[model samples]
Target: MNYTLHQLHIFVKITQTKSITKASEELHLTQPAVSIQLKNFQDQFEIPLTEVIGRQLYVTDFGREIAIAAEKILAEVHAINYKTQAYKGQLSGKLKLSVVSTGKYVIPYFLSDFLKKHQSIELILDVTNKTKVIESMEKNEVDFAFVSVLPEKLQVEGIELMPNKLYLIGSEKIDNNLNESPNSILEELPIIYREEGSGTRYTMEKFISLHQLNVKKKMELTSNEAVKQAVVAGLGYSIMPLIGIKNELLNGELVIIPVKGFPLSSIWNLIWLKNKGFSPVATAFLAHVKQEKTKIINEKFGWYLDYIAK
Candidate 1:
């Protein structure tokens, strides 16, 4: 009948993940510690809150209700903390964010200034594929998420930060040929694909489908860096976001092959669940993004902006 809010927080995490092991990892606690806490929590109540069935954690109906209550309590606690900090004209809290993999290139520019302004704030950033990012958003796991493609199914509020332009990139060896015959580049050079579930891969697929172009598949890489490396080695050409290849293009390590329909445009958005409570940190970040987006983009991605506009 009596348990610590700490234990309830752990219980909520366990219920969300359906695994004590995962909950432990997320909570940055060892398995034994998490287990001890869970046992101590259950000892407080006469009924078992969760049962281990088939090597998996299953929350009882009572456990679900307890988790819901814990969520509300934790949210209220966070709001109170945020309000206190805001009233003091200070920004101090952990900013939890999940970003799509490619956003690794873009989010830092936005975060750097914010961090400089509020040195007291801590950041926890998770870089993952769009699917996992969306799952985190739906579960209310992060304060905000940065992504180019927004999920149609999730109820979220967001503002577009900047245009995400995808370009056909290849080695300099084919520069002359690519310039002469842009369409033939697909037939001549094998196309390197990003692995499944990538937002980049999804956009490439859409572009391919729209053009009805049959591209030669040579290799599929799991990361944007791997794909860029493969393309630089002259293994194949890849359709990649310009943001990811800025340094390479600037240093002439990779060449952007001009194509008639290329530089496919998408928008990067800073998004959060519409129903989730907005903390002071989250609100500040949202306002910062909107207010400084143009300046940030112009500074960090001016070349991309110029290229896409051409």
Candidate 2:
């Protein structure tokens, strides 16, 4: 019943992706290499870990159970490696963060300096949607979650990092008629949207409903980038975080529609459960944010301050 850590890691990835080919690509191994390892690992156990049904791969019930255990083992191994680094007097551990898709632009700026200072600290930043980010926080899978809007159901403590301003943006090729009333523009143009569970979608819907603006929903995309691309391609307009579209705006690919009661704002917050305990790395990161948020914003987001001033 002896298995190497490599086998456990490969098996865990297989269970996650449910495809040997996908697992190989993720792990940077050849398909034959992954297959050989999978066969070797499977040979060590009597019960089947994975099964193939037609062309699709599926993890069996036992495989799911084993994957959970394998994840735990892998986590411990990571902890051990980090602990070894700590013994050398470096503040080292895994700093796991789940950030909403648009937050990818924001969080990395906040992290850049902190990571440079602490070279041994391992950063696992999961850039995902709001629903998945909240799910990770609920499952205690991350040290922190970066979001513009806080979840009503999760009682969490957070530090505000910066302002997240959302604007109704359209392709620059579209008519820039500032004379039109907000409601008239909304009613006339089709609107693209982030999928239902996105924070941007929530804020957009709230703004629409609060203003009671009659609008047409043209399409629903899952990510901020996708929505931005759609808007840039003149598919439709969308309420998007200003941070996510800076380059496009600068290059004249996209333009913000100046609507009354527009640029809906929220604070980008790094949040954790109210009662969650932090590891040394997480604690250091929190402290770093508290001390450097203002400086980071001033350096990285001065344009936003200028935009707000106007």
Candidate 3:
């Protein structure tokens, strides 16, 4: 459709979300408003943009070309915004960031301190699952990502951010039943697992495989929060990043197992597309990460730093 940059943005967002309803919610627009815009666009175009089939909306092949063009056009707009602001000697733009589910356990804390220090710069965070995190980064929807056990195939250049340990955690409901600590529960406890593509799940499974265990699973969960809740409900035990349970463990809402083959740790990565250029704000954020990396770790998790302390 022959449309302005703003309409192209709405069009691209709707295409990505695949539902007018979802796109409306994300854009803070009324569903009818999006509908009206789509109608207006169709009237101006040489061909139809979307077709409805069985309660689902599909962009036509012709519409796909328009969507792709819109994406590139929006990206150029964002690029110009970056250039315009950088010309003004200000790192004052929103840094759109996406992080995997587990990464939130620690990122918010770090990001808060960084944002407080850089008051003019904004951090727009999109906390999502691992697969979405990688896809969003690859699509240039996000400026930076902190992910765990990221696939090596991602066309992104990543730096090792930090190493994180996994632990067996369960709800406080099982605290009394825990005959031993999580580190010691690997022998016979039924374990709640993350879904198949989960990096955390893969890492945990690899640890069990390394120890040569039978690899029995109790249940599979999709979210870390759900796993925590399930363990709290005594539905089953689950292995999660140490940071995920730190607060709960301290609050006595969940307990760590003293199982023998635990403390399964893996490296966390800070990744960005190798060919993508960073905005001034993104560049500054990365610089902060590099400069304060050590002190941040020392203050954030003294227990983790103990590994290096020794």
Candidate 4:
């Protein structure tokens, strides 16, 4: 019963992807190499770790448990390395953040300099939907959560980073003569929407309900990028954050339609639960954000402010 760390790593990846090919691709190893290692690892145990049914691969229940244990082992190894870095007088620990999908555009700029300054710190940034981000915060799984809309049910403290502006956008190919009235445009074009549990979806629904707009429901997509592509293809119009569509807007691939009470706005916030204790790495990241947010916004997102002003 001797197994190497490399075998454990391969097995963990196989369980995660449930496909030998995918595991190989993710690990940057050849398929034959992954298969050989997996076979070697499987031989060390009597019980089967994975099974193939038809063309699909599945991790057995035992494999799932082993993968979880493997994850814990890997994390411990990372911690040991971090400890050595700390003995060298470097700030070394994991800084984990769960950010809503659209925040990908904003959070990276905020993190870039901080991560550069603390080269020894390990950063784990998960870009996911708002529901998952909030759930991670509630479970105390991450050090911070970045969202445009603050959760009403969570007792959390947050710092406002910048304003997020949402506007109804369409392909630039849309006719200029179409009625600019909010209800008219909404009723005229099929409206692409983000899926339920998304922060953007919540805001869009609220706007629709408030205006009593009868929007033609064209389709629902799960991500901002998907919605953007749908709109760019002239599939429909969607209310999207200006931050995510800067490139499309600049390239004239998309256009903001003027409507009454347009550009619904919210503040982007980096939040954590009130009772949660922060690690040293998390504290340093928070401080870096507080000191650098203004500068980062002015330098990286000034165009967004100017666009909103017009």
How many clashing residue pairs appear in each of the predictions shown?
A: 1, 0, 15, 0
Taken over the whole model, the C-alpha lDDT of each candidate is 0.86, 0.89, 0.77, 0.90
**TM-score between candidate 1 and the true structure:** 0.72
Q: Please, what are the lDDT tens digits per residue for candidate 1 over residues 48-132?
A: 8899888878999999988899899998887787667767888978799999999998899999999999876779999998888
Candidate 3 C-alpha error for residue 56, in Å: 2.0
Which residue pairs in model 4 clash with each other?
A: none
lDDT of 4 by residue, 144-219 (tens): 9999989889999999999899998999644544445677667788899998889999888998999898888999
- Arranged by TM-score with the best first, the candidates are 2, 4, 3, 1
lDDT tens digits, residue span 144-236, model 2: 999988989989999988888888889964554667667877888899989978999989899888878899999999898899899888899
RMSD of each: 4.6, 2.3, 4.3, 2.5
lDDT of 3 by residue, 1-310 (tens): 3577768888888788889999999999999998888887778887888899998989889999989988998888776876676677755678888888888876775677778866667578988777778778877898888888765677777778678788777664433344443334465677889887677888887877776776458888898888888888888778888777766777887877655556777787888888888877788778888888778877887876564333
Q: Roughly what TM-score does model 2 have, to 2 decimal places?
A: 0.91
On TM-score, who's better, 1 or 3? 3
Candidate 4, residue 163: how far the Cα is off, in Å: 0.5
Model 2 segments more than 4 A misplaced = 1-3, 45-47, 60-69, 173-180
Choose 1 or 4, whichever is better by TM-score.
Answer: 4
The segments of candidate 1 whose C-alpha lies over 4 angstroms from its true place after superposition are 91-99, 115-160, 170-172, 179-181, 195-198, 219-226, 229-236, 246-261, 267-286, 302-310
Instruction: Name the weakest run of 10 consecutive residues (lDDT summed) in model 1.
Output: 173-182
